[model samples]
Structures are given as structure tokens and as C-alpha cells.
Target: MFYRIITLKTTKEIWQTKRSESNRILGIVNNVRLFGTNFSNSRIFQKLLVIITERFETTISSLENINDLSTIILAELLNAL
Candidate 1:
């Protein structure tokens, strides 16, 4: 999510707007910091690596079946043409 408020340079208005903008930027920085910390602690990358490895092994084991299916489809397409 993104938000922006454009304000012309005025005496008091500029000061107030600047303060709000500074606060908003600080809030975003803090949120990103927290998210990075949590992501590291969760070890999500390791879990994803395990899942991808298992899926890849499964695919490799089934390559013969996949090849046969692709060959059948290609022959059918050529016949249609």
C-alpha cells in the first residue's frame, strides 16, 4: 500500500505536513525492520527449499510418463494438421 499527500509550500501548513511525512516514513521503516526480523526467525527459506526439493524429485521420477504424454499429444496435433 502506498499513500502520498501533496502540499504547496506555506508557512504553517508546510511545517505540519513535513512532520506528518516524517512520521509516516519512520513508521514504514519500522514496519519493514520488523518484517525482516520475523522472516529471518521463521526460517521460511529452509522450509521452501525442502518443499521445492521434494517437488523436483517427484517431477524427475515421472519424466518418462511426461515424455510419453507429450509424444502422444504431439502426434495427435500433427495428425490434425
Candidate 2:
């Protein structure tokens, strides 16, 4: 049986411990760009998606450096309400 692993405490920990390392967006884009489409029918890829997605969940978020994110989005996200 296939089991999906997920936990809020663990999610919180990774978000706090690692944020910049997260690359969910890049993976998704790569999956689309390279393979033309490679998300569905791929459990391994799905797991990767979840792993990095959890990075977005955090009690606190910060942008130590600005990248492609717009100023408005960065400001709203870094100083979340």
C-alpha cells in the first residue's frame, strides 16, 4: 500500500530550518519545461512537490534577498499579517 507522509510539526521544522533551499517552483517549472509535462502519474515527483511545498508553510517568513518575486508580493509575504 502506498502511504503519503506528512506532518505539521515536521513541516514547521523544515520551514524554520530551511527556506532558501526550497525549490518547489523550480522543479515544477523544470518538469513542465524539460519533459513538456511531468507531474501526473509520478509519485516520486509528487513527493518532491510536497517536500518543497512545505517550505512555504511557516510561522514566520523572510526574504533575506530578493529574487524574481515582485516588491509588493515580497513585502506582503515577509511581513505577513
Candidate 3:
């Protein structure tokens, strides 16, 4: 019947609309997850840099000249190698 056809078309339209909306929400969720991952990585890198700088400053605080600092750094690098 005509009424049955109209009802079937409306139901199909509604299902399609819901599918599109779900896809859009999924895209937003993926973007948020990527942003969270990048933010956490940035925070970790920043913390590591801070720790390294603090330790280096403390180690070199007693040095009076560039030559002495360079010598210490070279020795440390050589030891690492």
C-alpha cells in the first residue's frame, strides 16, 4: 500500500541520518584521542628536558671557566663512549 511505502521510506531515511551522525561523532572521538596522545607525549618530553637541564646546571655550577666546562663535558662524553 502507499502508506506502507511511505513508512518504509521514512524509516530508511532515519536510519541513514543516524548512521551519518554516528560517523561524525566517531571522527570527533578519534581526533580527541589523538590530541590526548600528543599532549601526553609533549608533557613527558617537557618534563625530561627540565630534569636534564636541572641536573646539568647542578653539575656545572662549580666550574669557573668555559675551558673547565668543556673539559668536563668532553670527559663525560668520552666515558659514555
Candidate 4:
């Protein structure tokens, strides 16, 4: 069996692409949650809120509202890991 080796450049490119896609999707979801009256109270939204608080070690009220949560998550992934 042959194995493929990935280069640093390829890894970086893949990371950048995934990050961009994640940010795009997060923005779309955030817009829907911000505008859709009933979505804010949705179970998924509440779960997301809990996750954010846990990840940042801060309460939801203490966290500053950001339009792009993916940036925060990506930064944490890069730095915290």
C-alpha cells in the first residue's frame, strides 16, 4: 500500500479554505438567528449559546456579541490547540 504525504503549504491552504467556509456558514446562521424572532429561542441556538460560554469560560451576557463567531472559534482552534 502507498501512502500520500501532505506538505505544509497544502495543509495551510486546506486550513484556510475550511476556515473561510466555516465563517461563511456561521455568518448565514447568525443572520437568520438575529432576524428570525423565534430562532433566538430555538433549542439549537440555546445549545450554541451554552457551547460558546463553555468554550470562552464566560457567561453569555459577558461575551461581546460578534457578527462572526467562526473567527473566534478558528482563533481558539489555532491558538488553544
* Candidate 4 lDDT tens digits, 23-58: 754675576668764543244344555554243443
Clashing pairs in 3: none
> Across residues 1-81, which tens digit of lDDT does each residue of candidate 1 receive?
011223454557655655664465446445646776654412332232243334245443444344443233322311221
- Number of the top candidate by TM-score? 4
Per-candidate RMSD vs. true structure? 21.3, 11.8, 25.4, 10.0
Q: Candidate 2, 53: how far from true, in Å? A: 8.5
RMSD of 3: 25.4
Q: What is the C-alpha lDDT of each candidate?
A: 0.39, 0.38, 0.40, 0.45
TM-score between model 4 and native: 0.37
Look at candidate 2 and give me any clashing residue pairs.
none
Q: Give the TM-score of candidate 1.
A: 0.32
| Tens-place lDDT digits, model 3, residues 12-50 | 775665455445444544564676664343343233224
What does the lDDT come to for candidate 3? 0.40
Enumerate residue pairs that collide in model 1.
none
lDDT of 3 at 17: 54
Candidate 3, which segments miss by more than 4 Å at Cα? Answer: 1-9, 38-81
Residues 1-81, candidate 2: write the lDDT tens digits.
001224435666656533433343345545665865544433433343345444344422332133223333422433331
Checking candidate 4 for backbone clashes, the offending pairs are none
Clashes of 3: 0
What candidate 2 gets wrong by more than 4 Å, as runs, is 1-21, 37-81
